[model samples]
Target: MTLSVQLRHGGPPLDFAADFPDGRITALVGPSGSGKTSILRAIAGLLPVRQAHVALGTEIWAEGNIHRPTRERSIGFVSQHYGLFPHLTVQANVETALIHLPIGERRKRALHCLALAHVEGLERRYPDELSGGQKQRVALARAIARQPQVLLLDEPFSAVDRSTRKRLYIELLRLHEQLAATVLLVTHDLDEAAQLASHLLLLRHGRIVQSGATSEVLTRPTSEEAARLLDIPNIFTARVDGTASGRNLRLRWGPHALRATGPLPAGIEGDLRWAILPSNVLLVRPDKPWGSHLENPLLVIVEEVIEMGTEAVVRLQPQGLSEARLQMRLPVRAVHRYGIAVGREVTVSLRAGDIVPLHTGPAR
Candidate 1:
């Protein structure tokens, strides 16, 4: 099951074509001003995508001589600011989507959905009486109340704080299994994108940069733009020293030698750039016994530390690359046990499997 969409517009020109699969959450993500929202609106029939052809499974929603109005299409939309209507009670707002439900069944279904969304006690309250998380749940219940064929979420969890947002995401996953509806979720958050999406479509400048399974797209990007959008850190210029299959990449960061995983890009053996994530780098105490051999040894100074409940984020200033800083997220307990403190000197270790070589450019 798939929803195939092809779009074209006049001007400097805007065009894109995508096929969203059914029964799974597909995320459409991009940087600011990337036309992600416009594409969402087009699918909801709120905005027009001229010359656009849209088909859902066996149904033809839009094409030559076939245009279905928004009402005729069974779709549920949950926008960012949505909640129970301030005037209507939570139950009423949620059940409002049931325009054709039998009178007796409507309220019962609404209550069931509210309970499923974990807001059973909040049915009598209005939007103003609920917290941000509660309101988002209510919005969710409202959207799913009528059991629409498709669901559209536009940054629905962005309004809440980080912890609450994560909880809501967990709730969303639970609901996803219970409903198993075709979901098209839009968000600017990379972490949220990584967690909630089964398939990811990276959009940029009113176009699609890449689209594939979440793991594939996130781990292996197609271009420098896609890599940058994925936020892979510590990218640097490099060259292919030797090779066996996809290995033997020789790269350096401010005089520090490095290696990478996977095949080096074609024609980029000499003078190319590579990237690595900070989370992949391990830090050992400076006074610890030295290992027999290491590819690259970096003498880094601790710059800052941020405690976030179970996790801690550490920023560092490397010896060779004082201009380019590094950031790592680790467990709070690790820092406590190791007695890690700001201004301390430590040696960071890089594993061959951790480095992901990217296109040549200035990695920021």
Candidate 2:
């Protein structure tokens, strides 16, 4: 069953509608105070809104003058803090979710859930006795003990260490595969969203800026604002010079002319914002002189190179530009092999298909 929601409020204003597909993970991501958590709370009936409509398939959870209580929503919620009862043992915490079940069955069901969450041995411990990761696992067990139809995770891994978070991600994916529960995950981490969610919703100031398949939204933001929010650093304003061929268009970026694939807005005139993903910008190898065959190859000076463990972020300034810079991400090995350093001249290729035009004109 798909989870559908429409919400509106005045203060801290939220006005957006979204549908979370069944058996798929849809991540709601944005900077802090973007209404990501508010949307989740509204859907789970934990927050009151002026106007809202929330439904799981044909079952309406909230609508005009009607709202169901949180308990009746059949959702498993894992808040950022894990929210485990301080006084309750791990097994008891999970068993609370099974209160509606037969008294004889609650213990067995709770134990089963604990085992499913990989915390069976720690069931006798209280929240204070458990590590952050262990507490998170217990919270997960408790959340799923009742076998909820929809899972609501609000930055569930944010409190854990990086290695623990990665392990939990795998566990969550595995559990989702087995249960096929519809999940709406709220997180600010873009990498986490990309790794876990198939669908993505980019929220900002209580509004949805974009929504689509994760790859599509991440690689091809529809607006300059969206691209900026996604932290894409290679946006440029370019003029539409003319058509290059049947499938390509010529764009003039300052002194440089670039070829880009189109479906550009019809009758589009003047300049528009365009962007390319850092990973899509290719560094030309000295051994292979195939830059001649590439669509957009430019000789640029390496302005800065930031080494980040196995990867490096290299900033390149095109030869004749005043302050414009293009950023590219490459493996650390490639950085050493190509001798990419500050103030060094280098050649980088920008594929026509990878250059995404943000809009035909100014974003509405």
**Which candidate number maximizes TM-score?**
2
Across 112-146, the per-residue lDDT of candidate 2 in tens digits comes to 99999888888888999999989888988888887
TM-score of 1: 0.83
Residue 308, model 2: lDDT of: 98
The TM-score of candidate 2 is: 0.96
Per-residue error at 169 for model 2, in Å?
A: 0.6
- For this target, which candidate reaches the highest lDDT against the unseen true structure? 2
| Clash pairs, model 1 backbone | 238-272
Q: How many pairs collide in each candidate, listed in order?
A: 1, 0
Candidate 1 off by > 4 Å: 10-14, 121-124, 219-222, 252-255, 285-295, 299-346, 360-364
Cand. 1 Cα-lDDT: 0.79
